[model samples]
Target: MNVLWIFAHPEPRSLGGSLRDEGLSALRAQGADVRESDLYAMKWKAVVDADDFGRAASPDRLVVGATSKCAFETGELGEDIRAEHEKLAWADTVIIQFPLWWYGMPAILKGWFDRVFVKGFAYGVQRPDGRTARYGEGALAGKRAMVVLTAGAPEATIGPRGVNGDIGDLLFPLQHGTLWYAGMSVLPPLTICGADRVSPGQFEAAAAALRERLRTLAIQDPIPFRHQNGGDYDDDLVLRAELAPGRDGIGVHLDT
Candidate 1:
């Protein structure tokens, strides 16, 4: 299996960093080809600007979606963004690792998606029927993605009734809205809680868990998110009334 590990953490000696190292080693040991994008080590740019589109964008007004689409189609995206795209294309599996901040991914990682997953490449794709291909069908369809996150809070505190909210719900925007929308099958995330306090024994357990997850990466079942064109939703793009009736919110989107 070919894997692309995208890591976003500022400190190499941090818990998230150590887990990343462990995860990569596990993948390599399993004979998987792996590539990494250590955002902080690379001093990755965390903002999108006119330079991303080059001459594809208008000088006076910048519409991100339209301009990015133009740039992607014309092969005018920034070199760095294009390089990441190439990596995405080459890998069958993608692993995104980071420490949860303010209940979301780090700013740099978010920026990576904003720039690298441009309209034409990730979102603005269409099918023969002229319908937008997304939420299970797009340029990155057939690939697999998984998120590995570390949190300062304890596991219980992030559970169903925890103050911090369920980890799955907290990550819905990313796991569902972005990765799944781009047509990549998303595996259940591996969340290491209580990151701020870990005993040596606890660290070993976490490492073992990560290694186990990687071992089954190729055959593991992805989260069953509903497909847009799979008849789960109506013509207006809303979930059909019969499915998950009376239920709403993020959970309703899951195929279950």
Candidate 2:
């Protein structure tokens, strides 16, 4: 299995960093070919600008979507963006490692997605029959993605009935909107809660859990996110009322 790990923690010696190291080692031991984008260490530029497309705005206004599409299709994008695309293409699995900040990933990682997952590549794709190819079909149809996150809150707090809300619900935007929307099957995330208070035993447990998750990367069944074009959704991409009858929110869309 080929895996690409995108790490976004600012400190390499921190808990998140240590777990990332352990995870990568475990993947190596499993004989999986792994590549990584250590965002902070790379001094990754987190902003999306006109430079990414190598084009000057004709009316002095940066046309981001259009520029990205043109640059991606014409091979005119800067080296960094293109390199990331190449890595995604080469890997069958993508693992994102980061600390949860304000119930979301850090700014740099969010910026990475904004810049890397551009149009014509990550989105704006189509099937040969002219159907919109996403939420289950697209350029990344055969690939899979998983999130490995650390949260400072206690596990209990993040449970379905906890004050912080269910972990699965909290992560819906990333899995359903971003990863699955790109056509990659989304896997259940590995979350380490109470990151700020982990004891030595907890660290060991976390590492062991991470290793097991890695070893089963190829065989584990992905989260069953409802496909956009699947019969569950109507032609307008809305969920069929009969299916979730009076249900709403993120949980209602799960096929399980």
Candidate 3:
């Protein structure tokens, strides 16, 4: 299996980095070809610019495909973005590894998504019916994605009555909206809590668990998300603009 691991911790010695290493090692050992995007090491750009859309001399004719000349012309973007896109196309499973910061992904990783997931690539795709493709169908339809997040809060503290609603809620946008919407089957995330005070033993356990999880990627069924444009909601838009609905015995519904 080809796997793309996008890591987003500033410190390579941090707990997040260690977990990422462990996960990568395990995936490699399992015979899965792995490619990593180290945001900090790459000094990745956090802002999107006009050049993201290939430049067209004629203002009215600006198109979305990656032009060969644009790749050499766009200073900020290099072969790396194309390499990432190729990795995404090649991989069957993708793992997003990062430390939870301010209830969301780090700016670097978010920017990676914003830039790498481009128009004519990630979104704005078409279907065989000549209709706009929905969440469950696209260029990335058969792929699977899972988040391996580390947080400073304890698991209990992130529960229904705790400071955070639930770990699942915190990741709905990434798991459902981004992955599922991009036509990937997202698996339940494997989150490690109490990151600040985790013991060596706990860390080791977490690594082992992650390895086992990666080994079972093919057999593990993905979280069944409701397809947004499947005519289930009004006007073919997300029921809650930024929230995913929850079904009984499925997962948490942040809006509820």
Candidate 4:
């Protein structure tokens, strides 16, 4: 399997960093072709602006979605963004590793998605019926994605009834709104909690868990999110009344 591992931690000696190293080693050992995008090591830019569109951008005003769509179609996106796109296209599996900050991914990682996953390439795709292709269909369809997250809070705090909220809900915006929307099947995330405190034994356990997860990357079942065009919703894009009736919020979107 061809894999792309996107690492977004600032410190190489950090827990997230060590886990990234372990994960990559595991992938390589499994005979998988892997590529790495160490964002901090690369000094990745974390903002989007007119420069991203080049000649495709409008001088009068800048509409991100529209301009990005035009730039993507015209092949005028920035070199950095285009390079990431190339990696995404070549890989069958993608692993995004980072420390959870303010209950979400790091700013640099978010910026990576903002720039690399442009309108035409990731979101603005359409089917023959003129409907938008997303939530299981798009340019990146058929690919698999997983998140390797680290949190300073204890595992219980990130659990179902924890104060920090369930990890599943905390990550819905990414695992569902972005990755799944872009057509990649998303595997259940590997979240290493209590990131601020870990002993040698704990590190070994975490490493083993990561290694095992990678070992089954190809056969692992992705989170069962409802597909947009999979007859689970109505014409207006609302979930049909019969399905998950009386239930709402992020969990309702899951195809349980």
Q: Write the per-residue lDDT of candidate 3 for residues 87-168, one digit (tens) a residue.
A: 7878888999988999999999999998787655565565546555547766577889989988899989988678777777
User: What is the clash count for each candidate, in the order shown?
Assistant: 0, 0, 0, 0
Model 4 lDDT on a 0 to 1 scale: 0.87
Cα distance off (Å), candidate 2, residue 32: 0.7
Per-model RMSD to reference: 3.7, 3.9, 5.2, 3.7
lDDT of 1 by residue, 70-112 (tens): 2245356677887898899889999999999999999999999
TM-score of each: 0.93, 0.91, 0.83, 0.93
Q: Whole-model Cα lDDT per candidate? A: 0.88, 0.85, 0.75, 0.87
Q: Which stretches of model 1 miss by more than 4 angstroms?
A: 53-74
- lDDT of predicted model 2: 0.85
Best by lDDT: 1
Q: Local error of candidate 1 at 101, Å?
A: 0.3
Please report the TM-score between candidate 2 and the true structure. Answer: 0.91
Clash pairs of candidate 2? none
Poorest lDDT segment (10 consecutive residues) of candidate 3: 65-74
